[model samples]
Target: MGDDDVLATLARERGRALFGYAYLLTGQAHAAEDLVQEALVRTFARRRVGFTPDSAEAYVRRAILSTFLDDARRRQRWSGVRHLLGRHDEPARDPAPAVGAVLDVRAALATLAPQERAAAVLRWCEDLTVPEVAARMGLAVGTVKRYLSTAGHKLEALLGPLPDDETVPLTSGRTRP
Candidate 1:
């Protein structure tokens, strides 16, 4: 098949799944779609370099992740202005409890150092294994474990125990919320 044919076929098969991956990372549907579309466009443009089928998916996924992270950093830099201009439309579902819970978690998370926060989020929120988290964050296994432990201790002090039904899994250990 020609390069265009191959790229089209890959997009036809993997586009939705790629968008879903982006959505998982971003927690925003429109942003995820935009990220995925941009990644695909970049991939198509680079097809002249002869990307293989197996590597194409990984390439696009990495691009999407990098794009999402870059956008997050940019948004953080301009968040004050964005918040001032943004609408206050709430989610379709009642997000009060969820928002409160997330805010609480975020507040507690902010107490930890950057590496600790990244370790905890990767282990708990992303449900990645310790090795996987270490690989992604480019930290040693021991360092990741230490960060998790430190983060867990701080969270425990800040948030206290969870209710019987609510469970929180941190990098170091799991706690009942």
Candidate 2:
């Protein structure tokens, strides 16, 4: 199959899983879609000699992880620089659906260190094993476990009580009650 054909097939087959993974990693719908799109574009933008179509999905996923982590680091650095500049500005507009059952959960997730949040998402939401998460994140397995544990503790404090397993659904595709 041609490169485009291969990518299309992968999207059709794994789009939902990919989207869910992005959303959990990102905690934002629009950003998640953008991340997925960017990953796809980067994956197919150019195919290397050893990059087989069968490995495209894995490649896109690795790209997504890289992109998300890089963004988190960039934002952290920018936040510090902006602080030095005394540019403490609030968001210009309120978030849509400002109140919902999942808002607390999302807010709580947002408070986590980026890597910790990523570890929790990969383990619980994406249902990946610790070793799998470590491999995806290019970290040692022990570090992944530590992140997951730290995230679990913080989430429990913010959420009151939560399951050790993945209790929170990745997406909140419903009207606020």
Candidate 3:
């Protein structure tokens, strides 16, 4: 199949999984859908040869993650100077009833820094190893480990005690920022 066909097939067959992955990272359905669409556009924006459905999916998934991380970084940067822009915070509203039990986990996740949440999701939900998560996030293994440790602690405080496997042994010695 041609690249277009491959992408179409991937979207038709694996759409839910792609959206679910994005949703896990975003914690909002609309945001997750937007992420997936952006990733698909990014993945296919340029013409390329020999893209299979599997490869297309992989590329889209990676794009989704990178886009999410990039957007998070941008939002973090904006937060620092947003008050200077004279924009007032909107009044908080109750979450929709559909949010239900997932609210606790999503609320806890919202407390984590973007990188920390990504690390936790990649490590625990995706079941990737520390090194693998590091590779996916383009961070050093030690950095990923530290992120996991911090996230684990924060998540535990909010969600109650986590499982024993949540801990990551930090390396001794100073890390250069």
Candidate 4:
């Protein structure tokens, strides 16, 4: 069959399934519909060699996932720079908390043992994985973990508890400890 025939067949037979998949990903009926429509447009934008109904549906589903992920990444990037889009630059805000927090952290680090301080710095500041921190310090993994745990406790006591779910790494090759 031709491309238009394949597209028509897929939309007639597999449209509900595609909409349901998009709904699962987006979690909103309107958003799901939009995603499905966008995916359909993107999938059929390029000419395909031999696209049956099933294959066309598969391609559309893949396009939906790609569009969703791309949108999420774009939103994240936009959020980081969105402040610059506004014209209001308030000059009355105090900037000392940013400076004070750095001093406070430095002071807290001074109180920790040398090994504990080193582990904390490598793991949090350097954004190294547990194994990487251990390798850099010439210590065992368990040893590095222990030092980090102790250092975390010490820092928390001084700086107050960090957010329970906050565990993003700055720049690491693998998962953060």
**Candidate 2 clash pair list:** none
TM-score-better candidate, 1 vs 4: 4
- Cα misplacement distance, residue 88 of candidate 1 (Å): 13
Tell me the whole-model lDDT of each prediction, alpha carbons only. Answer: 0.79, 0.82, 0.87, 0.88
Order of quality (TM-score): 3, 4, 2, 1
Best by lDDT: 4
Predicted structure 4, TM vs. truth: 0.48
TM-score of each: 0.42, 0.46, 0.49, 0.48
Quote model 1's TM-score.
0.42
The pairs that clash in candidate 4 are none
Q: What digit string (tens of lDDT, one per residue) describes model 2 on residues 1-177?
A: 678778888899988888999999999999999999999998889866555556888988988888899999999999878867554575555456556646887898999999999998787667777898999999999999899889999998988866644444444432223
- In the order shown, the candidates' Cα RMSDs to the true structure are 19.3, 23.8, 23.2, 14.0
| Candidate 3: clashing pairs of residues | none
lDDT of 3 by residue, 1-177 (tens): 987798889989999999999999999999999999999999999887888888899999999999999999999999999989665876665777547736777898899999999999777766678998999999999999999999999998888876554454222322223
**Per-residue alpha-carbon lDDT of candidate 4 for residues 84-120, written as tens digits (9 for 90 to 100):** 8764565665889978977998999999999999998
Give a tens-digit lDDT track for model 1, residues 10-107: 78888788989998998889988899989878767754565665578888898898888888888888876766765668546677997898889999
For candidate 2, the per-residue lDDT at 99 reads 62
